[model samples]
Target: MTTTSVRARFLGDGRIDFERATLGPVANGQVRVRVDVCALCGSDKRLLRSGSPVVPGHEIAGTVVDVGADVTVPVGTRGIVYIPVFCGTCRRCAAGRTNQCLHLRELIGWQRDGGFAEHVDVPARCLLPVPDDVPLDTAVLGLDTVGTAAHALRLWQRTQPDGVDRALVIGAGPLGLGVVAVAGAFGVGEVDAFDPHEGRLATAVDLGARAAGDLAAENQYDLVVEVSGAAAARETAQRVVAPGGAVIALGESDEPYTMPATPRWRRTDCYTVRSFYFPTSEVEANWDLLRDHGAALRDRLTVPVTLAELPDAFARFVAGDYFKPCIVSEDAP
Candidate 1:
């Protein structure tokens, strides 16, 4: 039998070229989803800078159109694709840290063909069914933006038994705003957000965090979450972290920097500093977080664009025109 054909896009230097590709039979334990929407992520900027040679959209939501043997989710189920592809038998996977699997293969958006097309195949184990009430567009951000923030917050909460006194999130981008949105949900008493961009800072304030122009607080915050991936932000996190406070660094820096900068440390300071990744097991809870916040939050936090406008949308993203750009199918509501 002839294979079905689907439209796919390949990335170039800030440009996208379209192609028609054949969709093969679904492999065992896999599902083919007709993508409804794919939210462009903060990390997608890395792809943009590198000329994003591969199909790249990790924050994906769609309807399952086909499924192979052993897959229980029926066809036509609305769902979101979990981006991290892990070896399920690894020790980390056993401990529920699939994101840290010993043999990490491809991340769906970066290393594999992702949801920048009419259809994409995903491992059934990586698929999470979207609840009926959750919009596919909002569901897209649940996979990465909110998921990662919730993961970071969960880790940060482990260090604060008495609850956080003041939580500061650096960068005021999607993830940063996410940190502000959910910090109080995680027992943070007061939340503050810092960003250089006034527009983003205002968005942060809208998300229930007090906005700050700079990270000049001297040892005032009990928790500081750094999401900017900028050298200066990391340096600022070090400066503002109170003694016994913790810093969760989620962003990646382009240049190498000396860890344990002597200037930012004091002899008696005891703090925990660590990097965080998405939690594959937390999909349901992450979806719940978005659902609980509802459309008022989702609408202010995200905007939808058609896939054809993705390339230009990305350009506008870099120019600071949109906060969260979600690419949706023409038929998506």
Candidate 2:
């Protein structure tokens, strides 16, 4: 087939440009999806700030419209596309850790074209089928937001076999929100969410977690998930985790985190801290979670807006006007 021309949006330097671009033909073992919905992530904000030329979306859910040779799923299958483009022969891919694949050629939103367009072409291996009952936006959230949280939770589980007593999530953003929601859904003993925004805390509370600015009890929480990359938040997470408790840091920050000098509070031997990133299997499980709690998750999503409104909407989103905003295709359900 000839090169496909599509209208797509490029975001960089806090600005968005929409124009007609010619997309290359789908390669072998690739598929083209008609994007139904794509959501903004914290990483998107960072990339926008950098003014780098990227398609700028990793959380994508859409319907397959075309496929290259040897594709498994037929055209018209609806699903969420995995972000990492990895070499299947790599050891990491063999172990189901595609995110860590040494031969990663591209990350859908970061290094390659993503879903902020009429159509996105991706490897057929990247497709994870979403049940028809699940909403497209919810499916997208399952891949990035909930999946990241799930990965962290799995790390915590590996550390503390008994499970969390009291859990603290430090951040009120989309990832923080996902942590709180998943904790609630999984029936954690007590989940407390901390954030600067009252609105976000309110939403956290609505999702079955107690909202607070900080943990009152020192070294009380068995699990502390640091979703906010702020140095202060990272320090707080370490301080509040009980001895031998698990601290999963999912946030990314450019600055280095320094340990306190004090002996009492600076006990490095007291806890376990692990960094996490999303894995493919976790995202598949997240889809199941989304299926069960789709309505609740849907409630947290900002009202969908058309692609034309994304620039202003993105500006507003950065200003804290929206928590998680979805870009809706005109034909999206």
**In model 2, where do residues sit more than 4 Å from their true spots?**
2-11, 184-187, 213-217, 270-276
lDDT of 1: 0.78
Pairs clashing within candidate 2: 13-51
- Please provide TM-scores, in order, for all candidate models, with all chains considered together: 0.92, 0.92
Q: How far off is residue 128 in model 2, in Å?
A: 1.0
lDDT of 1 at 84: 79
- RMSD per candidate (Å) reads 2.1, 2.1
Q: Whole-model Cα lDDT per candidate?
A: 0.78, 0.77
Which digits, one per residue and each the tens of the lDDT, describe model 2 over residues 1-333? 544544445555687778777766678999988889988777788777775465778889999888888898898899898888878878888898877888977888889888777788899988888887787877787876788777777766666666665788888788888888787555468888888888888888888788754465577677888888899888888788787777777878888766678785666455555544677756657767777766687777556877788888788898998887888898776
State the number of backbone clashes in model 2: 1
lDDT for model 2: 0.77
The positional error of residue 166 in candidate 1, measured at the CA in angstroms, is 0.9
The true-versus-predicted C-alpha distance at residue 101 of model 1, in Å, is: 1.9
Off by over 4 Å in 1: 1-11, 263-268
